[model samples]
Target: MPFVTVMAREAPVLVVVTWEKTVSASQTTTQKAIADEVNPGQWKVLKPRKGLQMIDFARLWQFRELLGMLALRDVKVRYKQTALGAAWAIIQPVTMMVVMSLFFGRFAKMNEQVGAVPYPIFLYAALLPWTFFASSVTASTNSMVVNSRMLTKIFFPRLIVPFAATGTPLVDYAMAFIVLLALMVWYSVSLSWQLLLLPALVALTIISAMGVGLILAAVTVRFRDFRYLVPFMIQVWFFITPVIYPNKMVPENWQWLIQLNPMCGIIEAFRASVLGTAINWSSLGMSTVVAVVGMAIGLLYFNQAQRKFADVI
Candidate 1:
């Protein structure tokens, strides 16, 4: 019989393995052989990250499968056992279009601002993106608290939970977009080359939602009151975002201030793209800058706060 001692070092930590051989004399193995068996691959040393580490994109990419699975789970759970199921997606924007058309277009005469475009179509186009953004933000804001059990039990990117929360709303967005196309056909709205910019606009909307959602999600872990505040914040955000009315309705002197709200330019550009109106390049550019800045800030703050999440949540 022989004894073998294998040692493996991983930065600030070291592991030692002790084994007693029961093999026959002809089948003897060396300490190096035992060490090779104990550490066959590169060690994955996970130490507590210091303040505000750069986002580990490689690590996130490795967890891509988990991200997809979490996103799929969210979509399934959202409509599970529901009567209308996905139809609620179409119904919500359509219902909102009707109400806004009656009050804003017919009574308040906001339709006049849109020129040739039909009020319902104009309203619904903006509603399409706004609905998606609102739903995503609300879901992402509460995501941390909703998945507290998983956070405590597992080890994965904390950012993935909020990021996955954004996916379920995109399902609703796609369904609602069908109704927008039908409305465009009914109103004889012609598609322009600007329609090609839609994918970019959708990305901008997601970035904006993710930016705000990350901040709120991180905060909600420490302050449960944020769960209640999220809905009201979204409602107020809807009004300031130029959803029901045209952006031009806001006076030129104050338009710059409105453009500071990232959704303002996104919704306005989305409506313009669908209705074949001239796109506001300046406002859209401003919005792009603002959205990118917000996302950077959100990521920094979320990363800094995530370390305390499991403890407080």
Candidate 2:
């Protein structure tokens, strides 16, 4: 605890305590010799990290209490003044599904593509992940800028800003998941053991959103134009992802492109777990790969850019 505290503060904890003599003088001398041998210096110098090592996850872990505090702060502050409060989480996605069900379901007859599954349930399943992704990214992108005052005064991991942003929205995901449960009941869709994998799917969604969010948050500090860029990027992303339609709606020849969109596999798997549809193992595999690779790149870029955030912002 003391080590982590030192790392988090970038300095030692200077405290006054009464030293009780629990052991003899010989034992104290022996322990001091061993400690000296293990760590010759009483203190280690703190320096800005270098190269790919810039991301000190160990340090971040030591500061994890801060992450949770920030995440909780975000969750509370999000709907503080809003009339609907946390209901907004359920409302946003449910409204989108209703519109899609009416417009695309009846007008477009989109339900035929995915067989007997009702369009609302179908769209709702996909919308869950998409909404989580979109909201998390938006929260993360704006988090650093919105908390500029904290950024200048405090020195927690800059990545924590995005990390916390990504976490807070999962609360919305959980609230909206109740609607998914209701949809399952209406459609008579049965649950499966694969439902246990929901946490993994959630994790994949987090990684994908946090990765993109980290890159955007860090870059937006340098180039404010990215603020405009993110919304358009996600809007285009929405149409391209299989949110309103099933993956088979895309041509087989172009299916390769669907795998490139990390959300494709996750959304499909989510629907499958809920609706008892067939799981596309290949697509899920590719999505996992994309999420992992993308996360690495995002963290690398974020760490590389983080050093200048306090000055730039």
lDDT of 2 by residue, 40-156 (tens): 222233566444444555557658898889889888888999888999989988888888899988888887887878788889999998999998998899888988999999877
User: What TM-score against the true fold does each predicted structure earn?
Assistant: 0.87, 0.85
Sequence-dependent TM-score of model 2: 0.85
lDDT of each: 0.83, 0.82
Candidate 1 ranges with C-alpha deviation above 4 Å: 1-36, 40-48
Candidate 2: worst 10 consecutive residues by lDDT?
A: 14-23
- Clash number for every model? 0, 0
The deviation in Å at residue 214 for candidate 2 is 1.1
Q: Model 1, 11-100: lDDT tens per residue?
A: 212321111112222134345466554323223344565644556554466578887898899988887899998888788888988998
lDDT for model 1, please. Answer: 0.83
Q: Pick the candidate with the highest lDDT.
A: 1
What is the TM-score of candidate 1?
0.87
Q: What is the lDDT of residue 174 in candidate 2?
A: 95
